[model samples]
Target: MTPFERSRGSWTFPFPGLSLARSPPDDRPTFWTRALGETPEVYGERLREQDDATWRAIDPTRSKLGAALCKGLRELPVPPRGRVLYLGGATGTTASHVADLVGRRGGVYVVEKSPRPFQRLLDVARRWPNLFPILGDAREPRTYLSWVPPVDALYLDISQPEQAEIATDHARLFLRSGGGLVLALKVPSLRKGGGRGPLSPAEEASRSLSRSFDLGPSVSLEPFHRGHFVITGHYRGTGREA
Candidate 1:
């Protein structure tokens, strides 16, 4: 039988670490991830109990990765039981879901620069032993080199002008060759008030990423997040630094 059964609103496993179901009264599609352990309601997401599994809905408006999935960007590199290094994991909203997706066997090394959000992230980490929180700067990826291993995928969502540069830098050091990459590129950061040039922000970011990665589709997070695009790629490990 297929994962999604329309006759009964049962949870369907689509991507690694994710579940899908139709919401009641409307039949609208909903995204969910299985909770690894006893985790409190970190975010205000609804939880459902069915088939002896607890699932939490991923809020697209709050999570860029969730918005990318809801928007139908399919090249997710994060595999089941694979390691991931998540940059800019603010308060662990998306990171929590990722941890659930990776399950107990995999690990998620989350790096958050700020202290306030990092504190909240610490609280979330306690619930999932596999989640390791690092309070450090993403711009300086080497600082946390000891904390992370050669990951199967790298997820970047920092709000910096050098978004593409940062992703490539970290990928070079941590991600294995041909590993998957997901970047949440904020358009305004790249433009910096500059008028539209021959290349759009997404195009410019793509150009920069093409140096170190075999680029894939770039999905736009529209109403949920204006001026944000999620770019997926595979690290080639052959291109020179941009």
Candidate 2:
């Protein structure tokens, strides 16, 4: 879908620390530059020179969400200004971009299990007022379920072998009816055996997700990154049971 056709919901809250304004309508080149994994130096220079608020430096090696956002922006549902729950918000790289997409009016509750990543995520959250970083495991939804209300979307990028199951569990609790979900499945994490196999690892991962949700169209990022797939699904009109 074209950017103009994309849906824009009401703004909930505009955080003070997030000073970066959206890029100008004519700045297609700038959008591509930020979409691709521009070097930190380049990203910083560009941000400073252009005074652009929408652009941020993302570590491609660490974040499949970043890669997916770059390519799958069009597919992501426009979230309501209510709330968003992001699982596996490692270091807040992709979470920050999501915060931008959700805008200040919306609330983004990011959950991360690792203390190391949680620390960094906290730092990123401090800069973006709308983001609330929760240090907890995605596998255990009950731990953080009370902290977040029902949300418009659930974004999952955890690399666990049972990543699909984990995401589904959280979706059941946090996602509102007709809410959206985006999952970045790591094929190797779900693979059972080593060496070149007849059944592609990605196919297996896809099957696992298909069992729980109506797997929507997917974007294969193998050209940009190896063994990675970005899958988006919605709870609405999906007959699958929780």
Candidate 3:
């Protein structure tokens, strides 16, 4: 199935919180334009000229995609022209940067369930050629599994009480054997009680993933954002083991 391919014309989806506008002027300031230390005008100019088929934004307030991009560039073993599956791709912000990094030869499959954010994601995909956006629930991998086969890396940024489980399910089904995974788990979302918990949210997530994969190094994005943890790991075995 592979979902729909990227197109240049306008398209619509059922995203709840997305507000689509005509592509902003080259001078309009975007959060990412600032975060990456590029003037809005400069960033906008570059975006306008970029011919890549896939592009998206990296909203800092909503997810740690921006922070993880900054950190992953320094730490993660992201290879050039690699494939990436981005879960919880709200509004396509972070997905865009990833597309840029991977370039035209590579690909990014962005799955977002929220109708609001999915709307914006649709809009961004119009210009970026390498980005493939799927408007569906990430929890139900079977729904989109046929369309999304194994990839070199799986990046998740879903904020839900069962985030760890959701991420693991995707990895088990779609991640290539020995592929890497980047999970941005939101602690508060997983809180069982109002404030009376013994094990922290992070601890629970780590333990859950360890059941299947060999959990690797993890880093808290507190220095860049609050209450976010980026955990990275590899699938437990070769294709034969699974």
lDDT, candidate 1, at 42: 69
Full ranking by lDDT: 1, 2, 3
Q: In model 1, where do residues sit more than 4 Å from their true spots?
A: 1-16, 193-197, 238-242
Worst 10 residues of 1 by lDDT: 4-13
TM-score of each: 0.90, 0.72, 0.69
- Give residue 65's lDDT in candidate 1 (0 to 100): 78
Model 1 residue 48 CA deviation (Å) reads 0.6
lDDT of 1 by residue, 13-82 (tens): 3454476666766665667887875964669988877567777888899989779877877657787888
Question: How much lDDT does each candidate structure score?
Answer: 0.82, 0.63, 0.62
Residue lDDT tens for model 3, 86-205: 988897766766666565676789999989988878777776677799998887878987787567778888777777777677777777777777788777776852225576778877
TM-score of 1: 0.90
* Candidate 2: residue 219 Cα off by (Å): 0.8
**lDDT of model 2 at residue 80?**
38
- Indicate which candidate wins on lDDT: 1
- lDDT for model 3: 0.62
Q: lDDT tens string, model 2, 62-86?
A: 4565465445444565363547789
